[model samples]
Target: MSMNDSWYRASVGDVTQRDALQGDITTDVCIVGAGFTGLSAALELAEAGVRVTVLEAEQVGWGCSGRNGGQINPGLGCDHGRVVAELGADDARKVWQLTLDGVELLRSRVKRHNIDCDLKAGILLVANKARHVPELQSWQHELEALGYDQLAFYDRDALQSLLKADYQAGVMDWGGGDLHPLKYALGLASAAEAAGAQILERSAVLGYEEDGRTVTIRTAAGQVHAQHLLLAGNAYLGKLLPWYRKGFMPIGSYVGATRPLGELATQLIPSRAAVCDMNTLIDYYRLSADNRLLFGGRASARDAQPNALRATMRERMALVFPALAEEDFEYLWGGQVAMTMSKAPVFGRLGRRTLFAQGYSGQGVALAGMAGKLMAQTVQGDAAGFDLMARAKHWPVPPGAPLQTAIRALALLWYRLQDSR
Candidate 1:
């Protein structure tokens, strides 16, 4: 299937297209990118009666926000234990609460806006190997100590009732779930507009110049002068700001959707919970509301989509459920996601008036929106939440593109070796 043939795009109905930037515009806060982060921030700031303008290179939800696995996994990108070790008990508890709040915020927005995205409950983190079972147990204990009580452990036999895979064990998180990502993103944009935010599509930001008082953002056809700016471009930020590029590596991940499986879908996953294995290169899959299996994983450092993506996805799916070997895939797509070395999001400031958030690793579905909300709070004179998130350390990737690519390749190779054992 072509890149444009993603199941999300095929199913997204009646999206309102906004005009591109023309002439100059001014707002209290200017945002770059209209994905989850930008739209979420726009919604928050506009509801607060702040003037906000969002600029997007393409349509809203055109990036990873629309194309991701759609699994709303809880917590930060890394385990909670790592968070506690790095940020102390008190701050870690705050961070943990914020992550849960992110999930709740998503739920509330979907309900408040009457978004038709098929929101569902339950997510299972499964152990791909026997060694991973103990690690999952430790993870569960760590979260329970942090006051999260929504988790339940399942051994191999117990897992068979929900999933017909070879996973050694699993941890079911009742708090996390899945949704129609493109529809969710579009709903955020609509809500932001209703709250008085202006969103301009097809307006790629060329660059920006920041004076001590105001920041001027320039696109091909227009410029936006604002008191503050929020960079929400994530992996798609490209070379717009070379300095930020070093803090995270953009990796391409692929996903495929089979033709509606009808009754077999429920048999594959009886509980309908999204499942992700404990491998470094994880396989995440869940059933679509219409019954198709949306399977994703297989990370690549290359800029282009991997060759024979459908065959590769089918092979991976068959490994977990042999019955799917003959299934016909109707859609295939891939997109880049920013990943930090520490697996925690990278959030910080560019100046007194400029703030940026990105590198959610594999957990951008919910955390990116929360990052935007916190940035909006910071813009409105409440910086405590943003400051706490900025405390998480993000190690820079090697400076040059070639060096970073080499490092990513070596890392993927190491992960493959580890997963094999």
Candidate 2:
């Protein structure tokens, strides 16, 4: 099977194709999907001496995990301030700490496993409009109240000095970072395998059969019978498990990596920070370690390729740094992510033995990795934190999903209007 033309595929060379499911293969645990959550869970499980087998429908990292903007940013997709407003300050504090720990956990994994994915430090939360400066300031205030310190303010004047665009301001998070997403995913898979987790590529799970305490994952070429099952197939999970899919509406995001930018890349963001805008449907771009500008945004709920990659993304990237208006695009591809109505991740039980987690929106890089380990903890009877996250109800797409696309379009229009204002 041909892999998607993701930035990771281009940067990391060809993905190894594993034959589809074959005969019966039993294990202590069976995890579907080779993306962040699945592989993260596998890595943790194997470390704990848990027998684990990870099955990917295609090659590992062949999903959004390898094909995103690669911004290992902190926090969920929504504003941490919004979280404070909705869930009260105490709960919001807990969530905020979790996100902080999420980033820390990601860094620890990369270092502990000796994985070299070009983990660069710092991410800039750039404001596209002048009005957004207040929000960034307010966020800084809240973080200060929370005793968080690691971010620097880049005022309009400061932005002009460091950037080539006419932007209002940006919040530079010294703690957050960027990386080669595909390479990171592959490294995670390799680490899990080294730790005793069985990883097989091209194993599309067809169906699962259960009898008493044993659950058998039936793949096209083989079957994995295990006592515990974890469903980490975020958006590629077509119908292997209908209940898990119901919690999220699959949506697509496109990314285009320009030809390496050489010195211009460092000049764009001297700190080489990942840049994301302030909007519900926003644009995010960052410089690859190799200096290619990786830009991502523009949501599509259906199966549609970007209309004009160079023109659209280059325009958006130029919005942040107009110096890249004519940057040459090297590869353009789209990958789908599971999005819940609340935009928070869903992690809970499916039936009695199966554990499920998905819908990280766009901030799954670290969150998903942490989620997998937490899910493993949940399986081991430590469910306090996992329950809190799982209990976060997901407002799924409309029953027929007929209005989802339209709703997202209108929602984008409304946010765009608000952003412009």
Candidate 3:
């Protein structure tokens, strides 16, 4: 489907367009990609009285930030137990707390800026299979032990009362919820601009060169010389920084929005909480402000044809709610999700002046904004939070595209097998 057909684009009303980079400029920090990460940093830095310039390849929030599932899920992309095992209890607790803080940060931003993004509360992580039930229960206990108390376990009957799905069990996270992703992103951009940052759209960065003291970023029409550079492009970073590409694989995830389901929507999800199964390759969905069932799943390492994407999404959605098999999808679109080998976010510094954070996997809605804030803190001489995230190890994929593709295919195949079991 044409990206222009995105329901987010249609629902966001009109946004003020900014001019592209037109002439050489200098700033304290030059950020590339005006998505959540960059825009969040811009808002923080600008408010701190720092000269920040954000250059976007397209309009602000044009990437996954604007097109994500909008589920404000708390915690890391990977399992919390694995994180505790890898980083140990103390650091892992800190990391877990940061994720929770991320959710709150998003809420505070919406309230502080009066962002009309339809923010809501509650999320259900349902068990797709009987085997997954024990795992979800254990996870909930683990979080409770770590001082998080806003979770509740639900049996199949209890889950059925809330969500009309044949799931075995579920864990309700009262802290997490959903929102209009594009509107949240646009609000951030506007807040950042109002805070004294300059945002340039349609100014794709061609390349950049640094000479010890300063980094010069080039665009088609202009260049930016700044003391520091932040790369926040995520999957869309492309070949700008090839080394970072090896650390994450860009996976295409598609979402389909059914025509407003009205009362059917409330019947399917009475709690109005965003829901997702616990499969290795899970199906996530939530109700839009207008009551449309916005379902998402069917991810692939490589891009698929739009028709095929829509068909697969339809099939997936039908699997959850068979009554909607014949429902018409009013909108369908795909966005790139950067998945690291470990599924943890990748944050680190390059040399002394360049920094980057990406590979949020499918958990960028809240975390990405927090990451940007932490990164800005690092730039302003406080690296505690950013340092903790940077400490997590992220292995790089094989060097070649062909090898990487093969690895991703094998991984997906393995996940499929696990899901089937």
Please report the candidate that would top lDDT against the real structure. Answer: 1
Candidate 2 residue lDDT tens string, 181-236? 88888889888989999888878888887787999888767688899899898877
Candidate 1 wrongly placed segments (more than 4 Å): 1-3, 244-246
Report, for every candidate in turn, its global Cα lDDT versus the true structure.
0.90, 0.79, 0.89
Query: Residue 252 in model 3: shift from native, Å?
Result: 0.7
- Per-model TM against the reference: 0.98, 0.93, 0.98
Estimate the TM-score for candidate 3. 0.98
Cα lDDT of model 1 by residue, 1-421, tens digit: 2336688998975678799999998899999999999999999999999999999998899998989999997798887778889999899889889888899999999999999999999999999998999999999998888778899999999999989888999999999999999999999999999999999999999999888989999999989999999999998987665553347898889988989999999998999999999999999999999999999999987765544576778899999989989986788888988988889998888878889989999898899999999999999999998999999886766667798788889989998999999
Q: Given candidate 3, what's the lDDT at residue 397?
A: 59
Model 3, residue pairs in steric clash: none
lDDT tens digits, residue span 21-82, model 3: 99899999999999989999999999999999999999988899888889988899888877
Q: Compute the lDDT for candidate 3.
A: 0.89
**Order of all candidates by lDDT, from best down to worst?**
1, 3, 2
**Candidate 3 Cα errors over 4 Å, as ranges:** 244-246
